[model samples]
Target chain A: AAFLVAPLQAADPLPSWNDGTTKQSIVDFVNKVTEEGSGDFVPVAERIAVFDNDGTLWSENPLPFQVIFAAAEIKRLLPEHPEWNDNAAVQAFIKSDVAALTANHNKGLLEVLALTHAGMSTDAYDQRVKDWLATAEHPRWKKPYSQCVYQPMIELLEYLRANDFQTWIVSGGGLSFMRVLSEQTYGIPPQQVIGSHGQATFEMKDGVPTLTKTLETVFVDDKAGKPAGIYQFIGRRPIAAFGNSDGDQAMLEYTTIDNPRPSFGMIIHHTDAEREYAYDAKPKSSGKLITALEAAPTHGWTVVDMKKDWETVLAE
Target chain B: AAFLVAPLQAADPLPSWNDGTTKQSIVDFVNKVTEEGSGDFVPVAERIAVFDNDGTLWSENPLPFQVIFAAAEIKRLLPEHPEWNDNAAVQAFIKSDVAALTANHNKGLLEVLALTHAGMSTDAYDQRVKDWLATAEHPRWKKPYSQCVYQPMIELLEYLRANDFQTWIVSGGGLSFMRVLSEQTYGIPPQQVIGSHGQATFEMKDGVPTLTKTLETVFVDDKAGKPAGIYQFIGRRPIAAFGNSDGDQAMLEYTTIDNPRPSFGMIIHHTDAEREYAYDAKPKSSGKLITALEAAPTHGWTVVDMKKDWETVLAE
Candidate 1:
């Protein structure tokens, strides 16, 4: 089919991925899928694979970057929400004191998410996310967060999709949040994003069907929840999985576990501190790629080195 | 520009939708968008139009037909859910007694939805919907429910897309349920279907991010809620709106009210009782099309007589 040939062209849709083991691995997978009569010619149904957003597809430096965006959004939204002036969590967010946020990062971040994301309908949340993405820049890179996406991984995504693989981003980030930018940045549509969600009620408000968010949390697609999110969102077990941190370990393990045919799992190791912040197995910010690294040989998982494998970092 | 032409010639994309009005509407829209001089030329960002599923795109004869499919699915799923044997609502669904269901349809349907759709994660619900859709045949039509799709409307959808309009299904049915067959039947991808949804909690059951359904309702995309759903899901007001009943009037009004350029608001009035079951003002099943008819002149909504507009009914 003509569709099969589109992915076979060696010229990378994202040339910035460069050429090395990571790029070669991506090319080999495409070849296997597109080449007829090859032992690895995966049926289209089983060809669907999913990846994580933050650390897997791009760099998440200076903090889980979405948090920064959320914090900024919360501040921008503060005027509309005057109650935040009295609320301790909202005050900390508006102040932009990392110490105050890190003092209770988990709860404080949740508070920020609640304040910014909750109360409004899901549609409002999506619009806010889109609006923020249009202007929001990475704190350190000072570029639009969309540009912060990894060049090699972006190539891999388009390459896989070109070869008849349907790729999805199964992330712990909020579904509405990721959906706002996934199609533009990753080529994955909103339906392809499976992630954390907030509580919603189906109601007719002034004759409009609205999905209003509640303070209550629905599902958080992180850590061990990655694999479950994949199953819940995609239904079929993914033939391949990609991630960069311990949060993605369960997803990796789930993908490579005893399938009838060959399955793939790859981890993006942060080795280039100059180009991007690199950390693994540290006390507070350890991305926990070490455990997956040690298990790779036994589990048949592919561990990718950012410094050694990728020729380029970010797509221009 | 090359990218736009590739998908069109790749396959006989809309073999079913080849009629005149439907086909020309699409061509005109696409010409406007792709060409420079057309006043209705929409930028890619704003080139979005949403449609309702069920009666709008396909035959909804057997009572919002998806509900009928769900009823059968409940029967098949009964062994897994033994509680149905003792539960009154479940028993009514299992026994297939409309009289019993009518007595308590709202609560009964809600109860059935809860039991049938609950406990399992979102993915499971999607799979169940898909499985039922694949095999289940409509009662009176005795054809695959997917085949029940309107041939002319399908043409309209394809024509609009050829012009660069991104079409979406804003339905009152469950999002996951409609998503199962939408891509194959309507060519509108799963992400494009915005409909009623239930609350789902993200939980790690055996190390996966599983979205378990809570006994809570999310947004219901029907009636005046159509506009809200379009704004929420698609992020823009539609240039064109197509629907069958009064449930879609708000969407039409919302689309046509105060638009800067030319827009279309269409209503598919079920007037062919001989060819297809026709009822405009039925007390029970009309779904409020009367108000739309009365307001059509004021709203400038085009009332489409199913008997007149469609040259063909179902996709052969």
Candidate 2:
């Protein structure tokens, strides 16, 4: 028993996490599900954990990273495509007017995405995203967008993987957009990243097969759509869910409520304006953490205060 | 070097496959990719192999197993819901009239699916499929549908998996239907099985979160749709693809043609009329292999003549 317990005690899987109730809760839940012969022990094959991307795993302050990427892409391509100059939505995007860009239910944002994301081979689109990620730096962090990921969240991901849990990203971000950086940034492979996707048409072009992305809208993986996406994509229920906004409310409910196996849910409360941008109830962009934050106590979900619970915010 | 060579010579990964050019080609491909310091050596993470279900992995002669399961479900539920009796499609299905069942481009079969597959919680649908698999037997084999898998194919699945290749099932079968048996029969997990799927609506029913299956076509993973489904589900292109009919032509092309790395394509020809139902130019149900079979020669894809290449057909 001493030999068995010593290794777990010595190794701090969540080194970035402060020695507080939040860290203990994660460890306790993992131990309960992984301990052999325990009443709550889940089989290795059933240990699925899902995470939301934008504000939960990384910073989403001024705007969601993909929106910024889309805007920059339009700017980069404007010289070649002069027709876009006359479009109001394109103009709104270029002017950095968030109100106009997101008004009328993200009409401008969708237009920006169509110009940048559609009518290209999937491979070509992937390269464009990768190039943007490599070159683009967060305005405030002064780090590459990929490096804006939370150090504490990265530790948790690794810890869960160490316990043989299959981690997946269920986000509202574009599927192709997240896939380019998923493996390198989060250790989650492309297949494990489920998000909003556009219709793709398969064709043999110039003696080579190609899947061209189209502007046709598919399911958006957020809120209630998260659970539906999980069913269609993951095929089974996840026992653990994590998020930072109201967009993940249905996902958390799906993971924890009435689950046959013991489940865990956690909310990442952006409470440290000094270390990270703090916004809730009225955020700057994208993430609105009102309903989920209110429901956290009733559902017995862990509310992680980033200012107090994290010893480190971002990687050095 | 002698000790290392001894195990390689001693083990036969494909015992059910006869020692011939077909088997040799498979071994050669595996060796080329797995050997270290070789030009064709692909990293383990990039080695993804996709397989078609039905005629490729198991028997689909009298009908696709899913169609048969749907018919059986209709009969089982007919007594409780007498309203189904007045329906012509339901009557044709119950009477075992294939002509009427598949007439008007499978209009009747679609009705059968609506009655059996939709209007239930996804969890309940999964249970129904499992129960049907448990009770239903192959008409000729007299074995459970789950046990009707091909022995040689199963061995091939194991061999690829042993070599650090991630195996996935990209089939035209229902997603929820195949997921119930994929892991148990093929050792492929639920998330790894990509197939035709129905739209599901997520809601809280009596305070319990549920995703109910809806009679809406989300996607049909067949023909050109195969490559599209792969783009949406798997993200990256697979290094290898396996299938038996024309439905997989697009998938095979997507896997092998112009891939930057060494790739493989194989077709399982149902030439053994005695052991398995043989149909290529025309199949009774879904699989029709004319174009793909003719194209195989041009593409240099291995064509496995089932009667000549396989030493074993179904599991004993």
Candidate 3:
């Protein structure tokens, strides 16, 4: 029986997954897919799966890491934007006052994004993001943003890829931000990232055709937006979707909306207060969507309790 | 001698390469990188190399195929825009008259792109492009657009990947268009594609955060724009660059510029009149840029005579 279960357990790429229902659930699904005669044999084309970055694959606590990067970039860029120094958002951002910036986080975040990401070609913004990611360390973790990725999730991604599932990162974070690290951390290439994007323009600068950033907004891959982003980016309903907050509810909902084969949706509830903060149903920042949470049982979605389910958090 | 040559050739992944200065140059570079004792052994992080898609990896004959796709999409969409019936550019596009569209090709292409790609979110646009590529047959080849890929280039892509080189397609064509079939045709996932784009917006529609297209111009990756696109998308300069015609000249120039190890630049000159049309320095559409062609010799760019160098063409 142990030998038989070995094959079943080994089906999960993350074999070291803590012995919990979350791990068991994943193992069962893999068994179903790998079983020669199982009804859930997914075709190669439909085997594509997409996950939200930030809160989904790793911790977005203490603020989305990319947001912090943007804030820093905005401060650096403030010298150029002399008028911005007087601007309320820019001033708050320059001061590094998290309270002020998060007072109206939505507007503040967008302002920071615009300031840091604007005035350059899409290519320039991308380069800036890459340059920043190469050196920037997370405030709490003191690790390179790339190094802050969750070990269990990273294993899950590799495991999925080994099983012929093409994984992608669809996040609300800036596309450029995610593109910088997706290839190295998640093994998902830059092209596989779909996220919020600012407008870019084609212009002749010094007699060269360049893509310049415009003051126009493109897609913002965020809450209630995940399904739409998936529809746009992947062009298919993901057979499997994993997310960690209410922002991911729609993606989960969209994934479970009746497909031919067995579909799986899992939510990582941040229940580990010691390793990571545990807060849900809060008024601000990754607030849990009560409706989706309540309906998880009926919808066949697995609600993962991080404290109980994950034996380890960050990858060494 | 045969035994020694076989081992040496086998060591190089691109073995079909001609035994000449060009072949030796490639072999020398690969040997330096793969040989443990060599000083040029680059770790995986620095091994990132990007490629230009259109004429570099594949043929862009009979005009950029993506432009043709846009034309077809625009014709299909024209019925909905009665205003376009009287519009000269749209009228020209509807009749499938290349001359009319080319008379003002930039604006005309923009019009077609705007109409075909606008109003939909970036996600929706990608889906439309994918659907079109699946069913739409190439005008001349009469095969699915995805099947029109160049065989030699496909092998080259796989060959590079086998050696742990990450290949990307940076084209002047729309990102969405190439992304549709890139994975199937070139093994390049959609995320590795960087191309021309249209404007998009972030909005909450029907209780979902979505990216909607606006009738605004974004970046057009062409000419000097190639380097910028590669920098923005891949954040690294390519060690090897391949292209045909002048549109790819900037990319070739950019790739071969001041790299540490041996860098390569190759141009596929269209000389096969029978297998494919051969016209350089002609006033026709897809006319090659003369300055880049003239500068090739001085720049150490290997000019490949398609008729002579290639054993096969198209992915048949």
| Highest-scoring model, DockQ | 2
Instruction: Residues B74-109, candidate 3: write the lDDT tens digits.
Output: 767767877877777777676766777766546775
Estimate, for each residue in A237-281, the C-alpha lDDT of model 3 and write its tens digit: 578888776777777766765455788888777777788678778
What fraction of the reference interface contacts is present in each model, in order? 0.03, 0.76, 0.03
lDDT of 1 by residue, B123-152 (tens): 677777777777888887788888888887
Q: Could you give candidate 1's per-residue lDDT for residues A168-249 as a string of tens digits?
A: 8888887777777888899886657887875455454564445576666467788767765564455466788898877887
**lDDT tens string, model 2, A1-316?**
8888887775788999999899999999999999999999999999999999999999887889998898889889999988987999989989989999889998888888888989998988988988898888899988899999999999999999999999999999999999999999999999999999887989888979999998775778989999999998989899999999999999999999999999999999999999998889999888898899999989989999999999999977
Question: Which of the two candidates, 1 or 2, achieves a greater TM-score against the reference?
Answer: 2
Model 1 chain A: lowest-lDDT 10 consecutive positions: A282-291
Quick one: best lDDT, which candidate?
2
Ten-residue segment with the worst summed lDDT in candidate 2 chain A?
A: A3-12
What is the C-alpha DockQ of each candidate? 0.10, 0.77, 0.11
Which candidate ranks first by TM-score, i.e. highest? 2
Q: Model 2: which residue pairs collide?
A: none
